[model samples]
Target: MNHAATTDMADAPVLDEDPFSDENIANPYPLFERMREMGPAVFVAPHGYYAVTRHAEAGIVASDHTRFTVEGGVGMSDIRKPGAWRTRSPISEIDPPEHTRVRAALQKILSPLVVKTWKDKFAQRAEEIAEQAVARGRIDGVADITEAFVLEVFPAVLGIDVPPERIKLTGELNFNQLGPNNERVARTLRRAAPIMDWYQQVLQRDHMRPGGFAEKIYEAEDAGDFDAGTAPLHVRSFFRAGVDTTIAGIGSTLKLLSEHPEQLALVKANPTLLKSAFEEALRMESPAQVMFRTTTGEVELGGVRLRADTKVGYHMGAANRDPRQWEDPDRYDVTRQTAGVHRAFGVGAHVCIGQMISRLEAESILGALIRRVQRIEPAGEARWRPVNTLRTLDVLPLTLVAG
Candidate 1:
């Protein structure tokens, strides 16, 4: 591909690296630093998309819907283009006015009272899991702790009845579709093919258990809060957004705590630091690594002009670690204040709607472990699962010492 004059913006650096490659997916910080240094917005030649690598520029791209819109879809490829993923999500894909109304209805269902009610149940489950993990002495933190707890509790809360394997398969499929359609997407789709029918059925009203979040979504649809036939898609949006990302975050927290005993000590002493620990871990690794937005028109970002109707990728993992945003950006400081500023949960109007739920889940599990375990040490090598667009652990081997 010709690197010369790819975009009208002469200053925009053309980066030839494939951000989604297996090597980069495993360890992206080096590439992230390079991308940030190249310019705020670098045109990726391999993917033919401009990447916003700095914290400030990424925020501008994500928040300013008029200039950078989601109408083209949040993935690397535009949904309007050929060979794209299925239609855009009603929640994440639409611009405001319409998005505002749908979001308001969903917010009503996930009100504080409802979240508080779920917290009680989550705490109970966390304590049980903590006790079991402590007794085991050594465990795979991903499979044994984060995945075990979230897969059971979150699905129960959503009123969906599906096995853990199916959930993992579908989560992999969802994240892969958000990136360039490559061998990874092909592989995941083939693997999930057998259960695709069941996956669709489970999100439907008939499969939603009474008195669960899924059922409530259907109820809201019946009341005309959502357009007809969009209820199932809403349920799907929640499942796709809520589950794997939280699992990735909680798992990353455990890995961080295990690797840094002093940070773990701080959290164990204060207990309140568990929330900070989770946030810091998210900033360090960032579960949802990259999201896309298309240019609504000619837009100036980071002193460079991007052409109209082009896709710009926000590398969240890169932005969260941008030195311009945080001092010693690479260090995992549990006390670091990153809530609103961090690009992990996102920024502006489309900031993750289910963030409170994720926090509640993380606090419940991490709080239980911190209270019960004296020390969290690495038992073996930690392995990261390579989904096209998600940064998550496949296995985190840890040893729990009883308090």
Candidate 2:
């Protein structure tokens, strides 16, 4: 494999060519292919950041915190620099020692034991949605299935009393804030502005429902497991991290399976493959499309020199499909063994801590759906909703055949 081509570092594409522009965002494979072939690291001129499109480079950038620090902020735009409206994620922005403390505390409350307890809840919710869609014979996957399942169950586990309408709006704001300042960010910011105050109130310890993880965080706070006042933020962190990504992930899986009949057939025949179906979808169309890190010192990646404090964007969607790492990279294959390998949930110390919960949720929900669905045919064309840092399906229409 000739990996040594003199990569033209200066000629990389611009973000105004809008990677998230409606057309490209809906189907970004063509653009991802261009970037992956361009180099391991290519300059995204419009956003003025380097994008690591290769699987290897994405992994390196994610794991090597010394070279790429999260302190600068995890979006294409630097949240630390002046005028950025986004506040740092107490969980994602802070690196180790501090990050370790916060993450460890949350991990204990979200342990496998706690997550396993939700299996019945997720299974019941999945059955309800799957049965409805199965009865209908045709369904809009995003609205009728994926969003319904996640929005129904995620909040229940968290013990939040959020309204259904607010879920999508809140997700839009959170994910948009993770990207560069753009129309998508601006629009979602406006949409979420009115509810911002109420959003704050719901995350507080006072609002936490009894027996929920939010309540457990308060218990930890009371017991001196974490800073006295950190409980609200701790609860807020789960809402921010867990919600939209899971919706986008499960939505993408449904869209992929609908579009690829053969793959759907495979999953139906071997129900265990439902897990891999979700993994393959996460690989092909990542939920968190990019995560940023700032350089603490001068560094070089793929021969391009970067200065300290410079931001780098690792495109997980691009990395997952990098031809160097995946054979027939764009194709969705249920048996690919791609679960832990994909950067969709990220890597290293800051890798998504709630991954097991996400997996358990997806497996339980998707598993139930697969068990009932004999075939999933495309009911209509799907559309992608462009957010700054996430890739998500806005709509997915799928027709199902009952078992």
Candidate 3:
């Protein structure tokens, strides 16, 4: 726990750990514990980046972009370098002033008023989905509930005409591509190969429906609120950033609620705790496990100095479970006041803009299910979908006992 800053930057601990390894990607908490025990910031030798494990240091990495700049790209690889990614997200990949302007434009488009109006729509769909799930009783929580609800409501709100299967495939491809280009990425590329063209074309202005959120983004672009030709990219960002992660979080929520009947009972007794239950699920298994930033200069994190221009990944999955910040961090306690405290939605200005939408979605679906189901019990073992930098459930079997 003693992470005394060394004057010699090279004195930082070097771990040969490959976090993207299939084993670690499947279940990372053990390695995360080891990494946290090592130091707040340790150089990951294999990937040649520093891993920030503790909560405080991770916060610094996420918020103080002055020290850990986003200019090098948010992913582990610096996109500005040769033969890397060609396009940066109009939102995530940029810094202040220009970022400020784009954010304002986006905020105006996705204003509280605009988002609030979708509540009834989300609730109506949520009720139908929940009723169907309860009627079936036995169900794959992933397909029957989580993916089904999110795939239906999220895209409808976004106003894109993507098939559910294609969205799921492309989501797998995107999350895998975020980290190392390992077998997982290769496998996903093969799976998504046929639909790559469809993925690209589906986000275009021509594809946006009149009343959907994507259409409004295009309208904003037309009104000089965004750069020409960036409307599609913004919509693309919304799709990529919003859908899969929410599905992952919601799936985890359902899985956890089923496994922890006590917590479910608490939620059932006090309906308000349903929100906390979802928050706890997100804390336990964050969808986006790690987010990267490049050090602008010699940056000191928890007294460990990081090399300039090197990538530093703030392991949200690890930080959320840090013993220093969270007491008995591994236990899934529904009463835990985790909403603002946990790093699940992220820290600082660049935090998930769609978090309210995510919250709305979770609350709507979970609320409906809670109202109808007396007990949510596991039907079989749950299997995690192993993307390099995402923790999500691929298969969650559940028995929805109706009230």
Model 3 scores what on Cα lDDT?
A: 0.88
Candidate 1, position 311, lDDT: 94
Backbone collisions counted per model: 0, 1, 0
Locate the minimum summed-lDDT window of 10 residues in model 2: 1-10
Give lDDT tens digits, candidate 2, residues 1-403: 1123323333343443556667766677788777777776666766778778889989989978878889888877787879976667777888887888878888999899889999888888888888887899878888888788888888989998899789889878878877777788888878888999999898887787888888998898898887767778777778878988998889988888878888988887788888889889899889999888987766767665565577888889889998788999878889999988998989999888888888888887778788887788887778888777778888887888887
Per-residue lDDT of model 3, residues 1-403, tens digit only: 1124435545469999798887888889899999999998888999898999889888888988788888787788898988784378899888786788999899988888999999999999999999999999999999988888899898998998888999988888888877876788789999988988888899888898889999999999989999999998999889999999999999999988888899999999999998899999999999989888998876677766777789999999999999999999999999999998889888887898998899899999999999998999999899998888788998998999999
lDDT head-to-head 2 vs 3, winner = 3
Q: Give all candidates' CA lDDT scores.
A: 0.91, 0.82, 0.88
Order of quality (TM-score): 1, 3, 2
Kindly indicate the candidate among 1 and 3 with the higher lDDT. 1
Give the clashing pairs for model 3: none
In Å, residue 57's CA in model 1 sits off its true spot by 0.6
Cα lDDT of model 2 overall? 0.82
What TM-score number comes out for model 1? 0.97
lDDT of 1 at 273: 84
